[model samples]
Target chain A: MQISASKWLDIWQANRRLTRRVIEAFPEDQLFSFSIGGMRTFGDMIKELLAVEGPGIEEIVTGVRQKFDEHASYQTKHELLDKWDAETARIDKFWADLPSEKYLERVNLFGQYESSVIDAILYFVENEIHHRGQGFVYLRSLGIQPPFFWER
Target chain B: MQISASKWLDIWQANRRLTRRVIEAFPEDQLFSFSIGGMRTFGDMIKELLAVEGPGIEEIVTGVRQKFDEHASYQTKHELLDKWDAETARIDKFWADLPSEKYLERVNLFGQYESSVIDAILYFVENEIHHRGQGFVYLRSLGIQPPFFWER
Candidate 1:
């Protein structure tokens, strides 16, 4: 493998840290309501991300699948952040149970989206980066300097 | 390696195709002037992608570095798309010169960022995905649906 499973975890964690900062940068009011070009607000985007990672890893580890849902709402930024932090811990715990060899195994994510486990995980990361990019623009439009993209 | 170098190239090309569709979706006038929340026009974002990939790969292949520049202007969307197609070819050509082993080598990209050649390449893809996400919002704001992210 070009990268060990643990190395990939580290990379994903770095990206998660940067994403946490993006969440922090948002003003509470704007986090859920401020969106440009008709895109979902940053808060909603976070919900989609939150819906995927921990549960996805848990499914991978347990050989179980759940319906994908991104509509679960948080009433405030603080609640959302708390959920995000909890998901992070959940992912770490499930990740420990995932054998590295399982990364090469194919699985149907969320009872749909069949792909190798690694690809599914990559999708989780890629999807986050994609939304976070929008978050970056959202911050910029608000005249805020988003944390550097490379800092991850 | 978890993925072969050729596989990475194929992945990048798929992304390039989607980004091309994004460029096509833009109205010529809006492509250059449209902004939401104070973000740069989509045209300017394309310039940065153009500046990075071909030259960055060339540097990796030739061991010669040049100053990064994203200021080169295009008169129309057609011209920018042409540049995009040309860079696609350039990346393919340079990619051929890069040995699989070289992916693990570290090089300073544009005399600034430093990382393994693979990470640098991953950044190129990740960066494109990032910007493309912003483009999705731009298109949605304009009421045009961007290409499906998963199609890549």
Candidate 2:
């Protein structure tokens, strides 16, 4: 009944793909300035995702926990997309390298999240979808149609 | 390192609890009428979750597919909270009845989604988080602060 690593990767990839589409739907001017309540802008939320997932997955692979940091600079939407593309590759590379059983092994992720790799990854994917949902709301408020959820 | 059904239930319960909090944070007037672009209101979104999860779990337990239908009448925020509580119990009842191996079995969920029970459940959890994220944005737009997401 255990889900294989490949299946987990597929789930992660689908969620990330959808999130990327959500990011692309954001208007350039609104991406960083739009805020709901006191929540960080969509741009800031995306940075948090970039900061967390890539390093979290990499640490899961290397068994070396690094301090949580927003590693890459994100200035323009294009830059964000570029870095997002790079991080996409990073996920495929490191996730492919992981031994299947390692997914079931628990790790203290980034000294913050402590769970098995699979659960940790689920948390990662769900977190992105959660934020992207915010972006969807933002786009709708701005009169833009956010991408469909199932398109990913 | 395989996750037990109990663990998955724990994850589901935590998510549902947080979602219930998100529901509580909504202003009465905004729950049903607020829409960004053309998306459903928060009330509609929560009803979808209520419709899906309780019955989805029941379907898995009985191996009988049922059409997706919104079961509860949610007129007021209090009614919504009441239904949420009932659905929480419904999940526990059906989920507890399921055999552990059923977690790996595939069901044609609502005659739509075709995936293993675990994936279906994960989809259920993620979908709620996604919509709740939308509600968070709505609250923010109304200058209302959403309940902290991590409180779960």
Tens-digit lDDT track of model 1 for A1-152: 27766677887888899999999999999999998767789999999999999889989999987668899969698998899999989988888888877877999888877898877898899899999998998898888889998887
Give the TM-scores of the predictions, in the order they appear: 0.94, 0.90
The best candidate in terms of lDDT: 1
List the candidate 2 regions with Cα displacement exceeding 4 Å.
A100-106, A112-116
- Compared with the true structure, what per-residue lDDT tens digits does model 1 show for residues B15-102? 8998999999999999999987677899999999999998999999999996699988797999999999999999999998898778
> Where does candidate 1 clash, by residue pair?
A2-B1, A2-B2, A37-B141, A141-B37
CA displacement after TM-score superposition, residue A57 of candidate 1 (Å):
1.4
**Residue-pair clashes per candidate:** 4, 1
Best by DockQ: 2
Worst 10 residues of 1 chain A by lDDT: A1-10
Residue A49 displacement in candidate 2 (angstroms): 0.4
| Predictions: Cα RMSD each | 1.7, 2.3
Q: lDDT of each prediction vs. the true structure?
A: 0.88, 0.85
